[model samples]
Target: MTDSTRPTALVTGSAGFIGMHVCERLLADGYRVVGIDSMSDYYDVALKEARHARLARSNGFTAEVGRIEEPERLMRLFEANTPDLVVHLAAQAGVRYSIENPRSYVEANLQGTFELLEAARAHPPEHMLLASTSSAYGASTEMPYRETMKADTQMSFYAATKKATEAMAHSYAHLYGLPISMFRFFTVYGPWGRPDMALFKFTRAILTGEPIDIYNHGEMSRDFTYIDDLVEGIRRLADAVPERPEGGVVPEGDSLSPVAPFRVVNIGNGAPVPLMEFVRAVEAATGREAEKRYLDMQPGDVPATWADTSLLNALTGYAPTTPVEEGVGRFVDWYRGYYAV
Candidate 1:
């Protein structure tokens, strides 16, 4: 594959903040990227090694720090980049660290999404994106949240290992036809984020004056979705591929998969903000003043989340609508210029 090398796209979690903005928008859309990551001290492994040292200085970006539950290192990274398209977004994300390490969410969200759906069921990747959330609508008192919503009650062991890796990627996209697309992200924040979420821990405890915890007393509500509008609605949903629904009769705010080529959209910002106006946009983006400390909503939390991105704008014509006070003032100016404090 070398007509001056530019046809790859394997991004598993490229030192992740939405997989480093979806491998910097697939290297600004020219593609050549292989990224796969495992720098998981769970957080700030030196900001995931400075976002894999700025995408390994982009000689068409190549990276590989293992662990997709090691199906021989994701089948040796799908036999060394035979990738046409596969963006699994490496798992084990948090929800109170899956109620205190429930086997690190059953070995990274159910055996690492069943070893990236068995390396896209032995290399059949033309379009396979799978990062799901909105806490898989557990305990649903639904208001907004759609993508065929009926995600049985998954209150948490990290949303039941992301709803058991969306029912093991809809039985490997209905027994290996494989064209999956399970996105469901919601409270995605911004600017190299994730030191355990809540707007990067309430903007690093409201710029270090320290206290912030809040929780249920702040009374949740999220659907935030920003990281450049969730990597531009996941690069327009890596091209909307999910067909198999021609009747199994499952409608009413849908969760699509009558039998799979799999589908589940909702990239959210379909409005839901209040957690005290998202800590008043990180206390007005770091002018400071948090010290909150409320608590008591633990044990797999859930107070609210909203997203009905109309089947991700009817399958990616586009829609993630960011604006949490300009995405919390671009994560408070990249957390005061990357922790210079």
Candidate 2:
């Protein structure tokens, strides 16, 4: 704790790609940040460690290593710290991986969130923001996904688990009067991104003279959001705490739950760029033409994703604006510097 006067933020998955950036932003904003991460080997553990190492340089940051699903892990944290703001970003990520290992999804996304919500119920925060996914909009052919839209058709187990957590949070909010926001994120990318993501994999393959997989035969599109942009959204939304509507009269177009102090907002770039276009941007950034191997779309994968960010703008007066080309260029630069390529 740097100072008792400063606000405290407990951030789960603090060493993850998005989590690291969020923790850094909160620390920069002068908040005392307590971060918890399991350091799961799903991706490169070294990358996760490096993210935490950077945060350790900040005197305001306190790092904790443990699984969120572990019994009493989050409860002990809440008991000791009593955080003012809680950001739940920890989970088992990846749609394809979830198919191979559905149990991980159940443990991390489902059980882990149960533990978090229970802890929050014990020591309620001013605001709690949990990360959901655009994949929650599964099977919808709508051009741009919205927060108020019916998102019951989650295509993958990963998405299903994420949606389940949103429901779980809502129930807690209703029961305990906890202020909660569920953020439905689109395709996030940029510097310090995950190795499993397309931007990272494409950049790595292109630089190493290897072929990149072009799923759905380059017929895909994603609202590729930049890392900085996403972090800014999270920071802004932290202050936009939800309040249960009076008399159960919710405003039109608002996803705020009438029964609870809860809402779901879309955090995305708002522009869906085609797969070939994204690859071209990578090539431009890396100065290497990628060898492409066209393949059918993976199971549980959608061909396109677009976000409707009106609710986010309405609430926080901000939306993600980074273009894929610029975001991809920054990521390639970071990748080269990070790997010494």
Candidate 3:
């Protein structure tokens, strides 16, 4: 039974990198957390289990193992927890992987989001925050992508599915009056980060004397947001729930939907760091130079991504403040300690 005195939050993908950090923050803030994760073998199940084990240390957390897309899975959890907050982070990640296995994206990103929306509709939460990606901005030459800008052109199936979820969520928010906030995350990296991410891969390769692959011939850049900063942004945004503006008059630069209590906010450092500079930061953190294998850009990849966080500041009075070098250093330290490398 959930404590009537404490707010309950249902976090999907609670064993994932961002999900674990978010769950920890919620637990610290006195919210009883109900977590559901499929514990997919996408990367390493041990890493996911480790994250879940850490969260289990808190009595406030209750873990359930199953895919969100599973029939009655999210619905049952919503009914049981009656969550005041919903943070949907589970998805088929990786741009290149989407090309190899597109069906997983359809099942996890599309069908899974559909199931979540249906569950939310049946049992409304105070706020439903779903993770989007800067990749949804897709091939936009715009230096700093804003939520108000057009984002119809997605370069990857992964991004396409994510963008589709935004639309799917918007309709549900409008029709069902569910307050929803979609987060457009930049390149998020930090301690307990996914092994598939560049920071982890590069750090591991550099420490192990293996060459790190430099895509786009080292001419790319990303707004690398630290995990803690991203989680803080999410925590604040949970309180800054969007309400459907009366008379459908949204303020300038606001991405709040005219007909729904829905909005899209970008959580990023708002600073794009060059790819090679990031590699240098890894070298600085690990005290070892990387043998770089420069390669052509992979399909479904953008050369650069920058974020406009003005809306995030306006709404939550917060913006991500971590530098890439420092964030990468933290990840490298964690990697060394975790892998004993």
Q: Model 3 segments beyond 4 Å from truth?
A: none
lDDT by residue (1-341, candidate 2, tens digit) is 44799999999999999999999999889899999999999999999999999999997999899999998999999999999999999999999999999998999999999999999999999999999999999999977998888889999999999999999999999999999999989889988999999999999999999999999999999988998999999899999999999999999999999999999998999889999999999999999899999999999999999998888899899978788889999999899999999
Total backbone collisions, model 2: 0
Per-residue lDDT, model 1, residue 8, is: 80
Model 2 poorest 10 in a row by lDDT: 1-10
Using TM-score, rank the candidates from best to worst.
Answer: 2, 3, 1
Local lDDT at 327 for model 3? 85
Off by over 4 Å in 2: none
Candidate 2 residue pairs in clash (backbone atoms < 3 Å): none
Query: Residue 178 lDDT in model 2?
Result: 98
Weakest ten-residue segment in model 3 by summed lDDT? 1-10
lDDT of 1 at 24: 83
User: What TM-score would each prediction reach against the true structure?
Assistant: 0.36, 0.99, 0.99
